[model samples]
Target: MSKQAVALTLTDLNADTPCCPPIAQRRIPAESAAVLAPAFKALGDPVRLQLMSMIASAPDGEICVCDLTPAFELSGPTISHHLKTLRDAGLVDSDRRGTWVYYRARPTIMRQLAALLTVEAT
Candidate 1:
């Protein structure tokens, strides 16, 4: 299946539980780790982490780039760069509407990250 198809399929799964066994129970393949590493790296910055949270938790399910920029001390272009990084990492999707871009979280990746981090009680 295509990567987009796989992402959609994974998002349809139960959210209360993980789709894969936790990291403690199974090792992550090098390929999978490589794929996920960018997402982790994108979130390593406090600005990017806050940006992701803002995008993910937006009441309308998406937020305009205009709205996102004012929340930070950085310049608009800097914020755009961070958003581009998030886009490159596949953690968020963006749509440009006329002059502004809107961003929304990609649930599939969020779920994948959550699944990997979940620690089941012993």
Candidate 2:
């Protein structure tokens, strides 16, 4: 990926139109691939994938780090590291509240990802 590709962001993709069609429909553009790669990489990990699902499905549309940690056998810092990766990938957003950090999925990026994976029925 070129440095130029690195500059593309999830927000750079239009909400009404995805940067590219479903990967099954055709090849993903270099720019779109670059923009989406980080998110795909972040979710490539089982732990992070699970974390994302939990955060995305939370009843309040957000979840606390405290609540997340108890579901896994890993150490707190390990979970925090995974959460940081998701945030860095723009897949999630975080807010510090007292001792716990709250996390919520970024719906725009989530939609972009979902669109890319969507395969229309033939």
Off by over 4 Å in 1: 1-20
Q: lDDT per residue, candidate 2, 1-122, as tens digits?
A: 34455446744543556767899999877777768888899999999999999999999999999999999999999999999999999889999989888999988888888888999887
Full-model lDDT for every candidate: 0.80, 0.87
Residue 2's lDDT within candidate 1 is: 36
What residue runs in model 2 are displaced by over 4 Å at the alpha carbon? Answer: 1-7, 13-16
lDDT of 1 at 96: 88
TM-scores for the candidates = 0.82, 0.87
Clashes of each: 0, 0
Please list all clashing residue pairs in model 1, or write none if there are none. none
Give the best candidate by lDDT. Answer: 2
How well is each residue in 1-122 modelled by candidate 1, as lDDT tens digits? 23443453334332445545667779865545655677789999999999999999999999999999999999999999999998888889999899988999988778877778888888
RMSD, each candidate, Å? Answer: 4.2, 2.5
